[model samples]
Target: MFADRAHAAPARQDPSLGSTDDPERGDVPGWVLITLMTAGLVVLIWALAGPALTNLFEQAIARVSGL
Candidate 1:
């Protein structure tokens, strides 16, 4: 009875679940955008903090040399 019912049901193909011909074509631009944004953020942070870091390093050197 189970085998008869299984054979009577038709196979359905879902259009939304179909495979794409160019899967990797969309990813390259997104990765490039992410990399550029990350680099820009790093440059901005370094630009903002560079002066204070330099002063701190100079102060540490002065204290160490005096000892």
Candidate 2:
């Protein structure tokens, strides 16, 4: 009997990514991840540094006013 090419596997599948068949399952969309990380970092920096900045500004204003 002749060999059957019909039952043969596909030529390539990436090992780093197991399969690309399910596009939705494995990876987060780049824009969505970047937006989330940017928002989180903004909130973190604001929370940590906002009060200090405000106090510094108030001190500068007080010094300017000679009070």
Every candidate's lDDT: 0.85, 0.86
Stretch of 10 with least lDDT, candidate 2: 1-10
State each model's C-alpha RMSD to the native.
Answer: 9.9, 7.6
For residues 1-67, write the lDDT of model 1, one tens digit per residue. Answer: 7889887967666767764455754677889999999999999999999999999999999999994
Superposed model 2: Cα runs more than 4 Å off: 1-28
Residue-wise lDDT of candidate 2 within 1-67, one digit each (tens)?
A: 2356767775886689766677756556877899899999999999999999999999999999999
What is the lDDT for 10 in model 2? 55
CA lDDT, candidate 2, residue 49: 100
What would the TM-score be for candidate 1 when compared with the true structure? Answer: 0.57
How far residue 13's Cα lies from its native spot in candidate 2, in Å, is: 25
Best by TM-score: 1
- Model 2, position 28, has a per-residue lDDT of 63
Stretches of candidate 1 exceeding 4 Å from the true structure: 1-26
lDDT of 2 at 60: 100
